[model samples]
Target chain A: MSVSITVGAYGVAFGAAAVANGFTVVQACLLSLLTFSGASQFAVVGVIGAGGSAISAIATASLLGVRNALYGVIMAPHLKVKGLKRVVAAQITIDESTGVALGQEPRGIDAMRKGFWYTGIGVFVFWNLFTLAGALGAQAMGDVRAFGLDSAVPAAFLGLIWPRLTGNFERALAVGCALFAIAMTPILPAGLPIIATAFIAIAVGLKR
Target chain B: MTVQIMTTLWIATLGTSLIAFLLKYSGHSVPERWLSHPKVQRINALIPIALLSALVAVQSFSEKSQLVIDQRVVGLSVAIVALLLKAPFPIVVLSAAISSAAVYNWL
Candidate 1:
């Protein structure tokens, strides 16, 4: 499932996007290699390309980053680190792993540990390798839109999100978010549109 | 850009990894009492969806080059068609890819 998640979600779309921009294969690969954050990367790229100052890009990226902050603090006690190990542990705190790890029965287990690291590391490795490959391969990948690779991303998104639909509220929120995002893409700064749309989705959908 | 390319990538990767490890190290500290907290549940509801929406929408729609609206649109529509028909995932994706590639190359 992690592989499935990684391939469609991270590998194809983000990798492709990284390459589509002017990022060198090495740079793209390395970026994905270390920074496991997704939205922030997108935000950073969008901000930079929009003629935004470095501070704006960083600020937008960092603002989008606060979510992981909560993950860090919440997962703090479970980590049980007292030394250098604490530093290593702190690095991988992300939305996906945190969500999965936190949902588990035990606070800490070899299984949870493996799952957390493998999913993050595995996705990271694949994402970077493919991102570079995709970047270098962009000429080869030529005209992905025709093949509807464009649609694959949003469609793949549907796969991850659709399953979580538990009620009218969730469904409504998602639809609202999607529509809002589409409407706002040309207007808002890179990160602002989607965030605004999603929260709007939450607020509006939950209203009923 | 290169600096950001270097800094943002390194910082994000290392940061995420370290945070993940620390969280993993912490393991499970969710207070049983907090398990059913209304606030926690509400926050959880909006957080991922919000994040996921941002991530997916930005990556898909934001483009660097000319936004072509031909077979790419055709391919996408067909994919939506495939979804409506409940065809297999790979088939839909591959078929769409092939169609769009053909569109770009020939027309």
Candidate 2:
């Protein structure tokens, strides 16, 4: 519940950012409702808002969405849903759901499944609700950036990713990827640098 | 002009959503052996850390085509330290916001 509410609340920034960038309230809400992935949704608005092509937006969003597929692989055994239920499950398979489920490892498989269902549904409900609230609020705020909300996105993201850097290799990879991306930013377009960072992981995997 | 832009936006949105759906659904379709492959596991473990780190760096420092370090970097540093100290999520967010706001106002 806490995870869902806090993370979903960040949708306010998305709402304001989306509107500030020229998306109608309806379109912003639709992005939240249909996509339901915070980072990818942000990527779409961020790219397009910066006057990049829609192709770049979609490419960036799709690149980030690839992580969900990995979460799906990790979750497949635990979920075991079939047919339409599988699709529904897949739709809600995101970072929070997967993390909550895996965090229950000490409690066994059934707890993990329960955690998955609870967190998935919980985040879905809260995320959509907050997205609407954010969209509506953005319509009223007029100038989202005068308040410095732009920084909130990266700050929140740092908080989200910081806890996961458990070991030296992970930290090193993260630093290396960050430096590589910073270097690439000058030569590549906005979205490509992010996508290019995936190669660092590939290289690390190859080395391993 | 408005209609053309809207059309492009909708198409991009739909296409992006479709790609995301397909990626999620493919997980169910892949064979167990393929998923369990050592190479796949290694890559999966590293992807999120690398991707997110890149995101943090890009979002914090990059401004359109150029990379500029600004108050957001300070905000991110404070958030990282707060997180390492095991500060609550709300506290981490609030501190970053407050600190950034202070920096923005004063400097």
The positional error of residue B40 in candidate 1, measured at the CA in angstroms, is 5.8
- Model 2, stretches more than 4 Å misplaced? A13-23, A46-52, A101-113, B1-12
lDDT for A24 (candidate 1): 48
**How many residue-pair clashes does candidate 2 contain?**
0
TM-score of chain B of 1: 0.57
- lDDT by residue (B1-107, candidate 1, tens digit) is 66866565444434443443333343333343543455544655564455455444444455532222455455555666776676655555556566666776687
Predicted candidate 2 versus true structure: per-residue lDDT over A48-165, tens digit per residue: 6544567877876777787788788889988899999999889888989999999998999999999999888888888777777777876786655445555666665666567768
lDDT of 2 at A128: 75
DockQ of candidate 1 compared with the true complex? 0.25
The positional error of residue B8 in candidate 2, measured at the CA in angstroms, is: 5.8
Q: Kindly report which residue stretches of model 1 are placed more than 4 angstroms away from their true locations once superposed.
A: A1-9, A38-67, A99-110, A139-153, A156-160, A185-192, A198-208, B1-41, B47-70, B78-96
Question: Tens digit of lDDT per residue, candidate 1, span A1-208?
Answer: 6455455444455555554444445555555555556655555444444333445455545544555555655666555665665555555666666766766637556666666666656555565665665556543666545445555544444444544666776766666665566566676654456456545644653553
Output the worst ten-in-a-row residue range by lDDT, candidate 1 chain B.
B20-29
Q: List interface RMSDs for the candidates, in order.
A: 5.6, 2.5
